[model samples]
Target: MTKETKKYNKWIVILSITIPLVVAILFGVKIDAELPVFLPPIYASINALTSIVLIASFWAIKNKKVKLHENLMKTAIIFSVVFLVLYVAYHMTSNSTKFGGEGNLRIVYFIILISHIILSIAVIPFVLITYVRAITNNIELHKKIAKFTFPLWLYVAISGVVVYLMISPYY
Candidate 1:
């Protein structure tokens, strides 16, 4: 591995570990007083924006616009990070909104929510590894991993919006 890739590997590990742990801890925490209750819509919009950016990034690479693709991917990563921060903050301060759908819809919502949660966690490492490969100029490896990463990442993004929509009425 290149030195650059090695340098990022440590960060990848640290972020992959820390993000979920912190989010899990914050998920259980609820403040006694109310704060500004704007995070849900903002983070949901971020997730929708991320899905758009991911699709645009894919199109950029398909047209051989490598630099554009890189920038868009970077933006997507930033969106994800911002979304995480806001999501954790919202959960920490407010109660979790439960899904209020009926029987079949509730089941469907849970399925999507479960898959989104698991894949959202999985996508973090894949994203970091793909980003490291790209930055290190390992185009072959980057492309290989990105083929898997893109769909998973997109699903996580879109599902986030869906999950929010399903639960928003209860919030």
Candidate 2:
């Protein structure tokens, strides 16, 4: 890695660890306040939008529309950040919503939820590294990592919406 690329490695490591830890700590905090809106649906919609953007990004890159791909990928990242903020805000203000689902559906919901949660955490570093590679003009390395990052991220985005949809009725 060039010095420029190497410099970002520390930031990527810091963010990759800090983000999940901060989110986990924040999940334990509750603030007594009435939010102006119901956030679950909003965040869920953001997740859905992120998925669309990710697909668009893929299509753009496949077509050699590099600028378009860059923009779409950035949008997807922004949507994800917005979703996280809103999700954390919602959780801080409201109580947890239990899944009213039972039997096979309940099992299925948990399975999706578990996988989604795991992948969401796991994708952080992949995303950061892939992004760094791209910004540093390390196209070949970026492409290799992005193959894994793209699917992992797309799954997380899609499954977030699915989890929200499955649990929304109880909220």
Candidate 3:
């Protein structure tokens, strides 16, 4: 196998095992009573920032500004990291937010929610693969997977905001 292939395969194994295990363990762990409440807007804002940066990164690459593109991608990754940290922190501390919508819009809320959930889970492997391809200098393969990754990431970000807005009332 090519060196890049071997590297990526190793990364895939590590991340594939690590992420889900972390999620599973974290998902069930209980926290202290009377946990501090975090403002959802802040986390939602991070998601918005991620989407904006992703779009800017796309524009940067389209213009062949490679360094700028890399910086933007790094910024996007940072935002994603920050978001995840806060998200898990919030969930661990506070009770899960419930959907408080009533009527037709309730359906709309759930639709957004279901899509958000499925896309969020789906995005994990895509992001890992996309990152691996880019880091390994497999630009051709990266670009091919990127077209899929970008939209899915965008959907996740946008839906994050949607979910926050929908559930904020109940929190």
Best candidate, TM-score-wise? 2
Off by over 4 Å in 1: none
Of the two candidates 1 and 2, the one with more favorable lDDT, higher being better, is 2
State TM-scores per candidate.
Answer: 0.94, 0.99, 0.89
Give the per-residue lDDT digits (tens) of candidate 1, residues 1-171. 767778899999999998888889888888776766678999999999999999999999999999999999999999999999888888778777777899999999999999999999999999999999998889999999999999999999999999999988887
lDDT of 2 by residue, 124-161 (tens): 99999999999999999999999999999999999999
Model 2 TM-score, all chains together: 0.99
Order of models, best lDDT first = 2, 1, 3
Q: For model 1, what is the error of residue 32's alpha carbon versus the real structure, in angstroms, after optimal superposition? A: 3.8
Candidate 2 residues lying further than 4 Å off, grouped into runs, are: none
lDDT for model 3, on a 0 to 1 scale? 0.84
